[model samples]
Target: MSRLAQFAVFGHPIAHSLSPQIHQAFAQQFGIALQYRTIDAAPDAFADAVRRFFAQEDGRGANVTLPHKHAAFALADERSQAATRAGTANVLTRLADGRLAAHNTDGAAMVRDLTDRHDLDLRGHDALLLGAGGAARAVAWSLFEAGVSTLTIVNRSPEAADALADAIGEPARVHTRYWDDLGHIGSFDLVVNATSAGTLGQSLTLPFSLIGSRAACYDLGYGPSAFGFLAWARAAGARYAHDGLGMLVEQAADAFQLWHGRRPDTGPVYQSLSTRSS
Candidate 1:
């Protein structure tokens, strides 16, 4: 028995996450045995619980997800430029002196999954983003930075969408459209579903026609949750349609890199999960 590095994903309703399996695969690539688990902590107790987790001798990092990403950013002693730009943090690392450092890997996860995995060139592509929650806000800026020609954000709450667009800066490039106007917004090279509509098993009636002939559709949810959106994409004849599983593996690899200076090969891990879901 040797020393083990401990890490976990912190969020509410985390039972279904594939993070532990993904991180385990990453650690095995470097011959490093690690402990990773899911931590279900509400916003009220997130900061305190995280403090305790890192207090462990082997505590190395924690991947923040869902409703906790913004809270994780708030609790960190220092934040990386990525986290600051995204207005959220999904990865928390224990600094050498035992302080929490925050980084948002979600946006980079999306970029990597789209570009590296699918070879979709995000640069100069028009994108339509669904939802304006924490996850949406975190990735909105990243897409713009990735060189999206224009980003049209649509959400139930028009005000929330407007605020997020404003925060993403360059008002001219980032604009908000009402949910009802989704269909009328015309086509997009990239249609990204950032809404929780998929997770709740709610039937989504998206305007998949918005997917251009050569467009790609991406759901932020993995597995079954992502099926609704991806199915719509496939039916709409999208060039490529995918779930968030790749994003999960890539982001976990990013966190692993932050914790151990090792970036794992994500192809096999992603294929493993994809096969399981299929």
Candidate 2:
């Protein structure tokens, strides 16, 4: 019998990560025996921990979450175009020659969830992205690439928002909004909340005008963190509201495909996760 393939997700507070369960469901689909775990690696120890994980013979791949995606990007010997564009990587795989390959699936995951699952058309749509953190940055590029007519990123720090807008190129299609100016920004077809406020259990007091009767609200943070935003969006009369659960599963599916040649079906897994969460 072949030795079991090993994988894991690394984060500062990784105990609550659902990646192992998601990957286990994917593995069961292909009859692939694998052991997936979560590792709590401090910021200073992140690089070392990942290095050690991929250096193992049984190690196949790992996902990097929150606080460590940039570290994972730096640690890789090779990076995909997506990772290069995003300036961070959330997935890493060990090559046959012992080199580490890195890529970002966060953007693709969001795109899949929005377009494929939600049936939202990105072409010529106006989007409002909240926050300027790594997750927001990754999804911003993806939204632009998906043909969004305009993307206005709002953040607490004006400089950060401006920097992200500049990096997105296409100055005509991308703009920055100060957190205080959110109310004056008008409405958007999509409003994505990528702020850590969700995870921190803080409610965002977004401008009521930003959400039209038909606007869709997406909270990039999942699980308990998304509840506040979901409530806020509903109270604001958003037509649709969703958390990052779909993105999480979709992104994991992308990572699974990168590590293993076969892509696992995400429908059943997503349904299973949704049911369990509810």
TM-score for each of the candidates: 0.94, 0.97
Model 1, range 119-146, lDDT digits (tens) per residue? 8889999999999987787789889989
- Cα deviation at 67, candidate 1, in Å, is 2.2
Error of 1 at 134 (Å): 1.6
User: What are the Cα lDDT values of the candidates?
Assistant: 0.87, 0.89
> Which pairs of residues clash in candidate 1, taking residues 3 or more apart in a chain or in different chains?
none
**On residues 95-214, what C-alpha lDDT tens digit does candidate 2 reach at each position?**
999999999989889989989998988898889999887888899999999998899999998898898899877789999877888878789888999999978768777767888768
Where model 1 places Cα greater than 4 Å from the true spot, the runs are 1-3, 56-58
Model 2 residue 225 distance off true place after TM-score fit, in angstroms: 0.5
The number of the candidate with the highest lDDT is: 2
Cα error, candidate 1, residue 148 (Å): 1.7
